[model samples]
Every structure is written in C-alpha cells, then in structure tokens.
Target: MSGERARILVVDDEKVIRDSCTRILTTEGHIIKSAENGNIGLEVFREFHPDLVLVDLKMPGKSGMDVLEEIESIDPNVVQIVITGYATVSSAVDAMKRGAYDFIPKPFTPEEILLIVGRGLEKRRLLLESEALKVEHERIRRNMISLVSHELRAPLAATVQYLEVILGGMAGEIPSEAKEMIVRCDIRLQEMLELLRKWLNLATFDSPKMAEHFQDISLSDIATESIELMKSLAEEKKISLILETSKDLPPIKGSKVSLEEIFNNLISNAIKYNKAGGWVKVILYGREEEVWVEISDNGSGIDEEHLSRIFDEFYRVDGRRNAPIKGSGLGLSIVKKMVDAHGGMIDVESKFGEGTTFRIGFPKFFQRQKEG
Candidate 1:
C-alpha cells in the first residue's frame, strides 16, 4: 500500500469489524479479504497467501491466538496484527511474543490501520530486496572467476610452453646471457600460471555448488603421481624429490580432483619455497583410523608470526618477499578448504630459519565418501 501493492487478510467474528477493515485497506490500492472465524481465517490464509494478517484476540469459534500460531507454522516472517475491544498492556505484550507484529484496540481509526500496515509492508519489501541483491552479487562473482580461468589462462599457458622451447635451445642457438634472460622471463610466466590456477581453484571451492564428490580410491596412487609431477619443478632448483610411501598405505574417501589438489599444493610449496640444492621429502603412513601424510622442506622457513596466517587467502610469507620465488599465496588456503570439506585435518609446523613441516590426516570413512 506504500510503494508496492500488498495482500491483507482480516479475521474477526464481528461483521462490522471485518467490513470496516476491507473498505479502508481496499481504498489504498491493496488486495483485502475477510474471514468470520479463526478456522476460515486459516483456509483463507493458505488460499490467499496474504502478506499481512489482522485477527481479533477474542473470536467465536477459534481465538486469535490459535490463528496466530497457525500462521507462524505456515511462515514465521508473515506480519500479524491482533485486535481486541478491551486493550490491556499485558495482553498486547504477550501477543507480540506470540509473533504478532502489532496489537490495536477495538475502534481503531482508519488512519491508525493504514500507518501500521504500511510500515509492515515496507519492511517485507526491504528484506526481499536485500536477498535479491546478495544472489545477484554471487552470480557475478562466479561468472568473473569462470571467465578468467578459461579465457585468460589458456593463452598464458601456451606462451609459457613456447618460451620453454626457446630456452631449451629447440630454436636456433642464442647468446648465454640472452638465454639466461629468457629463462628468467620463463620463470615469471610460470609464477603467473600457478597464481591463476590457484586463484581459480580457490573460487571453485568457495562456491556452494562445489560440494564434495567423495570416492573410495587409492590415496597412495594420487600422492605418488602428484609427487612425480613436482619432480621437474624440484629439479629446476636442483632440489631432490624424495618419497617414502608405505606399501600398505590404503585408500581414502575423498574427491579425486580435490585430493590431487591438496597433495600437489603441499608438494609444490615444498619445492617452490626451498633453497637451491635443498630436498623435498614426502612420507605417507597409515594409522588404524586415518592416513597420515608428512611433507617437509629445509628451504627458507616461515617465521612463527607468519605460521598462524599461512592458510589465509592471498597471504604470503614476508620472509620470502626478497627471495626469487613469487606466488598468489592462495595455495595453502585452497589445500585447507579441500581437506576440511573431506572432514580431514591439516596443520603446519615451521622454524624461522631452519625448515617447515606439514602434516595431514584423512579419516578412513569421510562423510561424503563414495566408490571411485
């Protein structure tokens, strides 16, 4: 009745009260309906689905209290106003606790009805608008992430591969200095690629639709493969990629894509943040109830102050700023999210200048576990 038309229902045993309310509200460009008793009020409520309801506190068949409870059961947010011939302070307060939006005494002025009902309708419109805005913002965020992941990343990856070929001397021979420069450019390109990948993965996990697709699969197989994939990166820095996988390391209930993401990020960080000629060690052992993974590196270790926030998005260790390595700092954050979604635990222990260690435990039966 204020900015937008509203649906209102009035329930009163008195024909005069019902008729008076209908005439007053209907003149304000509102859709109004009336019921003579509480039972018929409920029937009209369902059929009309009115946004606001007015019911007399004392009725012949069923009381206004009964109709208020029934309306609450249907939708707790619906606005309700209680009416009575004798206005009592205690009764008005009690009606409010029963979920009535307002209480008016019998012989309410038409102006009083319009003012109270208008306020309720405005509140409902604001709540609905707020919800719509939130949904729209989420949709736009998802679209931007999808576009960057596919459109921008594809071209950058191709360029990195082409530069790798030139640095590898697949093209005509070039000066040693020029070759070194190309390698530096290649490394920067690779950093960009990793950032894009990690950022995209972070957004994917953030989406509500990214629910876990768990499966009973060999965790050892995925770990081994992730380790092998990082061997090349380790070699680039002259670091050794060592693995100690127990022969009986069993399967885990997890998403294959997410599990691979978790393992790859841990192993990749060990290499990226390590000193040249250092080593990355990956150990996989199983407890009776869980599988434990430990990846340790003796690279430029993280300080204690940074350890607490290492899993936060876009958080980079300050100690590594002057170091040659660069990153988006979302790697560990993504790992933590994927692990948490699978109902697993991940933690890190690091010494300022000595080294760092990461431990992960995956339960035998994850809640979303499915057969691979």
Candidate 2:
C-alpha cells in the first residue's frame, strides 16, 4: 500500500467472498480481478499477469493446490498467497510447499489481507530491482574491459613494431650500446603487452561463446602437443619432460584453445619452477564418464599458506624464494575459468620442499551429449 500500486488476482469459488475481497482491495488503489473457480482463475492469471495472487484452497474443478504448482512452473517469482476456511497446519504446509507466500483464514479482517498483500508486493519489487542491478553491473564490467584493452594495447603494439624496424637496421646502423638499450626496452615493453593480453583473456572469458566452438577432442593429443611446446623452456633448466597416455581413451567436448591454455600454463609453470635435472611428467587416461590428465613436477613446491590463494587473480606468492620468478599471476586463474567452462575439474597437490602435481578431469564427450 505504501509503495507502487499492484495488479492483484483473487481466485475463489464463492461469489460473495470474491466480491468482498475485490471491494476491499480496490479501495486501497490496487487493480483487482476475480475468478469463480480454479480453472477460470488460471485463464485470468495468464491474461491479467498479476504481480500477486490470492488463491482459495477449497475450490470446484481444478484445486487451488494445482493452481499454485502450475503458476510456480510458469513463473516461480510471482508471489502467491492462500485463502482457506480451514487453516489447518497440514493444509497450510502443503500450500506453502506448493509455493504459496502466506495464507489468510476465512474470517480474516481486511487489515490482515492488506498487510500480507503489501509484503508480497514489496518482495516482488525487490526481486525485479535486484535483477536490473545485475544486468547494469555486467554491462559496466564488459565496457571497462574493452576500454582498458584497446587504450593500452594499440599504442604499445605500434611502438613495438617501430622498434622492430629499427632493430632490423631498416633506418640506419647505430652504436652497440644504444642498440642494446633499445633491445632491453623492447623486451620490457613486450612483457607488458603479454601481461595485458593475459589479463584481458581472464576478464573476457565468456563461457557461452566458448561453448559454441566446442568439438570432440582427445586429451592425449592435447597433452602431447603442450609438452612439445614447453620442451625448449624445460631444456634450458635441464628439466626432463615426459608424457604418458593410455590407449583408446575417450574424447571430450571442449574449446581447443581453452584446453590448450590449461595444459600450456600448467606445464610451463612446472618447468619454470623446477631445479636443474628435475623432471615434469604428464599422464593422460580415461575413467568412468571422465577423461583425466595429470601434470607432476619435481620443483620447489608451494607452501601451505600460498596454496589457497594461487588460483586468485593477480595473486603472486611473496617472499625471497619467489622474488626472482616473474609472472603475470593470471595464468592459473585463467586455467580455472577455462576448466569450469568446459565442465571439468582441476586439483593441485604439493608439499613445501618436495614437489607439485596438477590433475584435470573432463566429462566424456558422449556423456555430455547425452546429458544435454
């Protein structure tokens, strides 16, 4: 009553009761409609589209309990209230379970109905307002990501291209010291560009769009390819790279690029963090309903305090041990998002001074297709 006026529907068998409720509610500046039976009530509900409904428990033809259930199926957010002569605990509970907001007894006062209706309308308003806010927030987030990515990347990329031209001696020859400084600057700027790209990838990960590109892909092939890509980096550290796969493994439906990113990041990290003569092993196989891949390393393992926050965005482990290791800290976060998007699971195991292992499991392609 204190907020915006609402369209209200009252469904009952007795004409007197309908007229009484219609008269009482109409005076409070609320639009009202009434039906003499449950079946007629459903018809009026579809056309009138009231924000709140008042349904009588005992009715001819379709019962009020059935009406409550059908309304819930159509639109669960629509507020529902029950009207009954016998307001027994069991009946009230049944109506509530069927999605009734509240119930008023046969001999109730106008004030009682008005109070219940007002509460229901307020709840409806809040639900609508919350949904609107969520849409607006998502819009702002998307716009911000676009702005940052374009504003920083366009100029930096152009600068890098010009530097490449100079380094190629296209313009003229230069002193060795000057050329070295230019190379150093180029390296740092390239690092910045890579970091910016990773940040955008994590921020703009749209699962629905990614799902459109999904195809049946083999985890064994993905793992083998990722190992080949990481071999150069591992060789520099004298870290041995090994991949083992089970034959006749089942495939999974996923975006190839996202799955590649997951494996690349995990394998790269394993090699970068390992000591000389250490090893990184990738094992791929299939289990019931899922294809599992594990990457393990004999590297400096994560401490207990740092493990919890490793998957968080821009969260780098702090201390002297990790000081020399440079990273954007967005890799694991991106990996986690891509895994979840593909209907997969990822887990990590580590002991402080021993080693670390990462396991990823994806639902099999045939099973996913069946579920869909």
lDDT of each: 0.85, 0.88
Superposed Cα deviation of residue 267, candidate 2 (Å):
0.9
In every candidate, how many clashes are there? 1, 0
lDDT of residue 85 for candidate 1: 79
Residues 114-164 of candidate 1: C-alpha lDDT, one tens digit per residue: 888898787667666777799999999889897887788898899898888
Q: Report the Cα lDDT for candidate 2.
A: 0.88
With a 3 Å backbone cut-off (N, CA, C), the pairs that clash in candidate 1 are 215-370
lDDT of 2 by residue, 66-126 (tens): 9999998887878999998898989999999999988888978889988988898888887
How much is the lDDT of residue 269 in candidate 1? 85
lDDT of 1 at 214: 57
**Could you tell me how far off, in angstroms, the CA of residue 104 lies in candidate 2 after the best superposition?**
4.1
Could you say which candidate leads in lDDT?
A: 2
Off by over 4 Å in 2: 1-4, 26-29, 35-49, 57-77, 84-100, 103-107, 171-174, 319-322, 366-372
